[model samples]
Target chain A: MKRLTRMQIPYRVWMFLFIVIPTLILFVLALTNMNLYQIGAFDLTLDHFAIFSKNEIGIAFWNSFFYSSITTLICFLIGYPVAYYLSTLPNKTRKILVSLMIVPLWSNMLLRIVAWEKVFTADSYFTDLTGISLNLIGTQTAVVIGLVAMYLPFMIFPIFSVLEKMDRSLHEASKDLGATDFQTFVRVTFPLSSSGVISGVIMTMLPAMTSFVLPARLGLGTISLIGNVIESKFMKEVLGSSGMSINEGAVLSLFIMVLSVAAFMMITRVDKEGETLI
Target chain B: MKKRLWKTRAWKALGIVLMSITFLFLYTPIIVILTLSVNSSKRAYSFEQFTLQWYVDVFRDPSITGPIVNTISIAILSTIISTIVGTLFAIGIHSLQKKSRIRMMILNNVPVVNPDIVTGISLMIIFSLLSFTLGFTTVLFAHIFFSIPYVILNVMPRLKRLDPNMYEAALDLGCSRYEAMLKVILPNISTGIIAGGLMAFTMSIDDFVITYFTSGNEYMNVSTWLYAVLGRGQSFTPAAYAYNAMIFAITIAIILFINLKKEKKGKLA
Candidate 1:
């Protein structure tokens, strides 16, 4: 057993206060009936759960899920090819390309969302060119577009890492056996990179589901994803009297937490299945 | 053989085309914003003429300046605090036994994977319960909350790779634990810390969702200010574009510097 140092106690206590305490408060607040101004005695109630079951919340939850799923799918479709292409490049070029990809990540995410708003807002150039006025600014389509754009790098990076480590001989041997390039890619490359694909999908989907800024900004406050709903409950005073009931927000929070956990579990399970197949 | 060669060339051309298209999609909006910043047009998104008036406006306007200062202050403070705390926590965690490390690792990753909205709402709820005022302090605290996880994750890998015996050697030479940590551990992990700090600073500066929820209308960060502006159905402000360009330029410069440093280190090694 390592000896516990005197200084460690204060550090551990600090962590407990900052990290664990907030988490506990979130749980208790989710369970109790409390308003923003009234910090009275806690009464445990399932009213929040009922609120979640009612109109708008259910629809919002479904919308958040479907949007995230579609974004993840699109990210996978686009990112996989890019990842594959990057993996095939010479080392120096590959390094430069990877660096370029990550450079955008360093920029502020909100800034990027605002940049998209510039593109898709009514009377923007895109609308003019297409002739079809895509009212994308406040639609689910805009949210999906933003999520896919923001999360593309997450999908690409993992797949690129996996592809870089793939055995070159497999492809060469398949070619020598007179297999076409497409066949080799389908039979060998796709299967081999499945773990990365699973991880990338998970990484993209998990964050996409919970994202607030992009959806809230582009969705024009018309569509309330779980994130926006929760924010409204806690901060906007739109749900209950003077900042929606904490208990309701908390119940919704628990639902979100469960959804996220389930999404993660599905990803891991898929990853395991892919690994076994490989 | 000629046909095969032609096919290979065609494939290469296709790959390049695909990559360029992707790049266009990724960068056009940024380019558009930068261009509009210099455009002489009062109306945003309509290219009337070219001028530097927007940059001038951003500098001259108090409303813009206040939010810019607030964002910079919060980012700088959060980066500094989180870097210190995260570096210390990472060092301490590295000293623990392998068997006891799983829980700590999971806890460390919680902030990153937890949805930002959930985190924001939870923090808001918790702070209000504790009677913590929603202001600069609350925002800073919230920023630090997420920032520390990134810093710790970045620094810990570097710390683990360090030679454990180095600390013992320093202590045997009569150096105190603080001296050993400062002299030995810190230098090794400085790069990771800097990288993490830069990331944290950018995230905090750019964050709107968490800041929006926690800020409580006390003061405006750049993002929150922009949201308010945009919500009013006003055209994109040229000043906002200029501000964004400044942020973009800084981000690009940092990335280029990091890349150059890595290359230089690679060559030296």
Candidate 2:
């Protein structure tokens, strides 16, 4: 056992190098004006903080929050019942259905986003077949629909797994105690699966909150999330755009990272082993 | 009693309908992609006719083939490396005291939960800070970094389920520690390792955000390639749809095979 501990040293070093160091660098970059182009003129300045006050940044933040919240809520409302129903399913049926849910995830996400873009756009293949032109591109509804389609599985699996592994006797016990089906669920099943619900919510919300591609495609330049801002900033630096600021991107990244860590800490409080994370 | 039974039947029908709708929502985009793959139309906006020309073009086009090759090669390399290293890490972590194990799990999760944009940007920052050029090697490193945690998490649960005395018994039977690990431990946890490898491959194959930041001017996987094509406002060859459809078909086949095999094993048992 003691000898085996040596194997972890390498992984520990890898983690430190990649995870710990980069996060520290992000924090430092967020606070200072230091960037790739001007590495020698290193000085701490809180100037990047002013971006938070910008109207665009505030709107981007609000859009991220609003869209992600709606996406998560829709996923939960759809997912929880679906998960509960799936949990009641026979074994072979349940397995097949669950795999069906996950198959879309295995597809290239960008391609799927593009597919939705086609469906939402007017004069699409869908319209060619159905004779109904949606022309929904650039709408908030399109982005939300794309998001829910992409991430609903994240919501379902956690709740389903928790419910599947839940003590079946509890439901029976509640029934024997004269609880109605609704009472049994509300008092027994839902509370027990709350951890899974939390896990599912966080999983769905985090990705939805940070998603850039869906908004870029479905929103069609009408919508911008914080993620799109970060992407453009980094891309600008890469493209050598004039007035490129990686530091501003770093600030936004740090803000998102803090939100993520806070969400993760909530998960740890409920699920110590970090199970259901998948 | 009749009214209650009628209500229960109604609820069941509603449940089935809801499930059907959710599944329909999930599969609609995939169905569209599959349809568009063989559509004779060059543009995804409208269907011109039915043809398999795009499917043939998938193998013929350089841009399409190049990204397909990159996506597979990176997924393969990262899956293999991460599975091996992550298995060892899981075993190592399994040997630790409780406090350290919990701490390590928290550290393991940073990559797992961190937003892809942040992860990409942070890694991009660090690579530039180190003066390491971003391209194939950086992309490979980034894949491996994010992937190992999944492997570890998948393998950890198996390690927990293993009998504590199995290794000791192997040792008492004259097996060396290395032999004990190989003959006793590895065999027991092989399923977890395989699942983890599959997961790593899945993640790597589909990744865009991290690869986008780290891929620099040289490398492009399918997702990043699609992003680039779309970013330029160019209508890409429908070969992309063909490629994605092929992947979907292959994944379905693999999953069905796995499930069928599991069913056979269960019946035999």
DockQ of model 2, rounded to 2 decimals:
0.74
Residue B167, candidate 1: Cα error in Å is 1.7
Residue A209's lDDT in candidate 1: 79
What pairs collide in candidate 2? none
Model 1 docking grade: acceptable
Candidate 1's residue-wise lDDT over A1-278, tens digit each? Answer: 13212323444665576557766766676777655457767787666677866789888888788988899888877788788888889988988888777666655566677768767777764344334345579877888777877888888887888899899999999889999988998998899888788778777887787777688888887777777676666655554454545667777777777765665455445542122111
Residue lDDT tens for model 1, B74-126: 99999999889878777776677764453465556555656777677767766
Off by over 4 Å in 1: A1-15, A106-111, A121-140, A165-195, A220-222, A238-244, A263-278, B1-18
lDDT of 2 by residue, B1-269 (tens): 99889987887887788788788778878888888898887865677788888888889999899999999999999999999999999999888888898888888988887888888887887788888889888999999998999999999999999997898898889999999999999999998998999999999999999999899977899998888888889988989989998899999998999999998999999
Looking at candidate 2, what is the lDDT of residue B165?
Answer: 87
TM-score of chain B of each: 0.92, 0.96
What value does the lDDT take at residue A198 in candidate 1? 71
